[model samples]
Target: MGRDLSGTIRSFLIILALSTCCFTTAPPDLQARVEQLEKYYVEIKEHFEAKIIDLETKVVRLEAKVEKQDSLLADLKKGHKPLKENVDINQHCRQNATLRTCHEIHVANPSYPSGMYWIDPDGQGIGDPPIHVYCEMEAEQSDVKGTTSILHDSESQMDIGNCTEPGCYSRPIKYYASDRQIEALIQLSTYCHQNIMYHCRKTPLNFNGIAYAWWNDKDGERHKFSNRSTTCDQLAYTEGYDLQYVVDNVSLPITRIHFSNPFKGFGQHQVSRLRCRGKAKTEAMPRSCEDLWRMGHNLNGIYSVKGAKQMETVFCQFDKRPNEQDFQKRIGYQDIKTRPVYFSGEGRRLFMEKLIPIPFDHDVVNIGGAMDSHSGVFTAPSTGTYFFSFTGLTGFKGGVVITEFTFLSSRGVEEKIMKHSTISFSKLTTFNPITVQSTLRLQAGDKVWINLDFRNDATFRFVDNTIFSGWLLEEEI
Candidate 1:
């Protein structure tokens, strides 16, 4: 037991020694110890606070950068939007052989023997060359009256075919020709292609029937004639063969040619003079008289006959009549002027009040009482400079009452005041006229009103009535 007690005492002594050592190392004054602890805490807090402040600044900068990046991305998206592809003939010509060939062919045959040719660099060729042909026929005025025969041949001396029977003789003979007939012979020789078909059942005593008749088959067909049948002696007929062919073949652009020689001299109206300039593919070639006439109408501006001076008067007047739908686009009747006024009063006694509610259309209302009063208001339908005029009179003492005249903007905001007019009792019963002029910067849908304040005791009668007239002088800047 004694040994155990000694061991416990020794352990307690060791613990006491350790406690004494800790107490001796600690600061003695509370204020000093607190100050050291506070210093450490402040240093640690400042370090953490600095780090947080830097992080916050970085966050703000990052946000701004993100916003800028987003704006750039939106701009890039807008800039990358696709654009429309414009048609480029140069590119198409380089890529398409038909276009190239058509250009080459046009260069080779610039002008036809008897027509006009307009070569548009951007226009597409109708089709392959020599595939289509145009045949023009005409009946000449001749004194002889035998069967008019036309023979086709590969050569000038060679005979291909001719009209049989009564020899197709007539005062005004009609004619027909085929593209195959022309193509077959035109390919061989120009002389062989001279033959054209003409047939007429009736034989006339005089050859003064049809001065001209002809036909041609191109991408489209054409026909022309000269009639000396009426007083005007103008060229006239029913639906022409050229017009019919053009209407039937909507796909092809057709042209017509007309020839008239007021002077019937052989030298004046030679075949060369009758020939027209023509365009096929991109080439200009000499065209027949009929083909030239057809194309002349298709071309812009005026055209005249070659050679004969009097025949040059023959020109085409393009149709310019307006269609029904075009006429309907116009609204309101013209040549009518309307003046409207407003009055304030009950039943028959109502007198002209301030001009408020200017009637767009004229409307009549009966006044009720002897001392009735009313107002008038005029609203401008559009923005423009305007002139205003009004006329009226007073018939009784204080009868003619003065009213406030004002103009209002589209927002119902008053813009200007018109002159205030007052009349004596004696003058009230008399007729008077008022006029005012003012410059207004009125937006569309603005309004102008006249406010009339009449006394109950005053009895008045208006002469020539009160009316408002506004005329647009000019557009306001």
Candidate 2:
């Protein structure tokens, strides 16, 4: 029994040893497993951290994109503001108001000669209204410019102010005062005067009357007076004058008056007196008292006429003034019949028959004119349609003539006129003279002169006589 108990003890000790070894090995394996788990946990934490960083980056990008879009929308909202309400008001006023009608009634008068209505449409009567409007608009616009900033701040106040209400139409809104309307009317009147009246001055007269006229009654007789003329003889005798006298009295100077000799009964003294008084001898015949009384009253019977009527007949005539044809044919005659001066020069003489220069590239030859050394330019004193003529004998070769002319202009801006022409010799002594004609539009301030340029070094000889003839012309009706 002792042996058996000893064996059991040995078995128990072996099992305990085995159990201790298995326990130590299990702990080492478990520790290794725990280390592997720790490594896996560290990898998971790093992955989670990386994922979180990526998500944060994506969120930041989206936020910036949203912010940019939001800013763009805000800017778009700010750019499109409404126009001012005053613009509407002004448009309405302009549309409703008849600026022209107001002007005609307020500023124009139908009767007075100096009144606005009588002003010619093409005359200076127009442009007054537009100028006034421009001035007022300019001033008001300047004020608007200065106050624009304050206006922007009070944008809400720019509303039309309940004008759309139903009762506002009948009830006069106190906004547009009577004084404002009066001022507007005055402005419109002035505008019409300036624009219509002033611009009308440029128009031509189509009808035949004084620009303005009026009728007046004096001594129970009605008379018409013209603004342009003050001739008492022009008074039409519609009902008063017994005999109308048609006189041959022109505005021009009278050279002479002729009358035919009277009949044998008329005395020389009566004929001479009739001639001096611009009456025909037939019209001035002396009559006996009996004959003169017979036309007006009943004569007493029985008594014969004491003197027979001295019958006379005379031809009324006047000297014929030089016609336009005569004046045109005469050369070298001053416009006022003054003597013409001759010029001696080395080049061909150039004459500007008209104040205006001929068109460019015109053949001007043998034109006669004297180049005045004393005066730089030719002086045309008389103001009329002048024929400026010059004759050139073709002795000069390779010579250029420059006619430097100036015309005084009452209206236009150009002050100087220039013309150029070349002179060429045909043979040793023979040359063709060029003629240039130009209708110069001249005013009172224009003067014409000639110059010479020689190219061949040869001395040019030209006649110096220049003709400036002008005839007085009536103003265009």
Candidate no. 1 TM-score: 0.23
lDDT of each: 0.33, 0.28
lDDT of 1 by residue, 98-128 (tens): 2211223233332211111112211133211
For model 2, what is the error of residue 19's alpha carbon versus the real structure, in angstroms, after optimal superposition?
99
Q: Give the per-residue Cα lDDT of candidate 2 at 410.
A: 49
Ten consecutive residues with minimal summed lDDT in candidate 1? 265-274
The TM-scores of all predictions, comma-separated, are 0.23, 0.19
lDDT string for model 2 (199-304, tens) is 1111111114422211112112222222322221222322221111111112101111111111111100000000001111221222322222212212222222
Error of 2 at 342 (Å): 18
Stretches of candidate 1 off by over 4 Å are 1-351, 358-378, 426-430, 455-457, 461-463
Q: For candidate 1, give the lDDT.
A: 0.33
